[model samples]
Target: MYTKLKDELLVEAYEHAVRSQLDGEFLQILKEELDRRGIIFDEAKKVATADNNKS
Candidate 1:
């Protein structure tokens, strides 16, 4: 189902998923698809996570 989304949509969805803290198998599918498509999150979430953890 997720494989049909455009690159931009997929990236947005993945970012939202990460920000929303959505997990389980649903998020896994997004992660797998992103990797399969060679699409990365650009470390936006990575920086966020690091900042969040510093508190």
Candidate 2:
């Protein structure tokens, strides 16, 4: 349950970061944080796209 929540939050943060156009050191920091949490932003994006397609 906790893992699921964490994953959701990470995805949300990733989406926000992308929308915010974060770059350089700030973007690197976000990537490192996600990596530390074992979250792959690309996979999350793919999953999100697939889900949207399904709908």
Q: Pick the candidate with the highest TM-score.
A: 1
Worst 10-residue lDDT window, candidate 1 = 44-53
Candidate 2 on 1-55: residue-level lDDT in tens?
Answer: 3554455676676678888988767767766766666654454364233334457
Task: Extract clashing residue pairs from model 2.
Answer: none
| Sequence-dependent TM-score of model 2 | 0.47
lDDT of 2 at 54: 56
C-alpha lDDT of all candidate models, in order = 0.69, 0.62
Q: lDDT winner among the candidates? A: 1
The digit string of per-residue lDDT tens for model 1 on 1-55 reads: 4657776687778778988999767789988877777664444532222334469
Cand. 2 Cα-lDDT: 0.62
TM-score of 1: 0.60
**Distance from true location, Cα of 45 in model 1, Å:** 8.8
